[model samples]
Target: MIEYDSYGRMKYDPQLHFNQGKTWVDEDIDYLIHWLEIIGYEEMSLALGRTEATVRDKVFKLRKKGLMKEGDKSKRHRKLLGRCKDEQAVNY
Candidate 1:
């Protein structure tokens, strides 16, 4: 089941039956990027079943390592082309 905190950030229940392999797949990362493209980092956390802080931390690390591009930092609300919104480094 999808879990949420009092503030609405998504939470995970370790007691819940879990298949680690299925829970943390490459596609999940893609889903996070997709949500990051839609709403923003904070909302992407909820959509991807993680805390906003966790999302931000991961994004920050990825950015620091140059795996995630600045142009892909947030969803584009304007007409800014030539930016890659799909290219991403695999994260495990």
Candidate 2:
């Protein structure tokens, strides 16, 4: 079940987003990097059990560290459309 704020926006729920505010493990980071290149933020968030904001923030940090390239929305869109080959298997 989901709860909403007074403004009708979804409220943050610990039960739904259990990893919120938790330290990211190395495995999680690896998974995030791999999937991030192929999926959009919302899909990545749901797969990682994290909020979209948190996922975006982490992606920012990873890019800052030279760990990831700038995400190309068009590339991801192509992948979603099955136009690109699945180069890597999705672990999560």
Query: Considering only N, C-alpha and C atoms within 3 Å, which residue pairs clash in candidate 2?
Result: none
Name the TM-score of candidate 1. 0.45
- Per-model TM-score versus the true fold: 0.45, 0.66
Model 1, residue 84: what's the lDDT? 29
The candidate scoring highest on lDDT is 2
- C-alpha RMSD (angstroms) for model 1: 12.9
RMSD of model 2 against the true structure = 10.3
lDDT of residue 41 for candidate 2: 66
Give lDDT: candidate 2, residue 84. Answer: 17
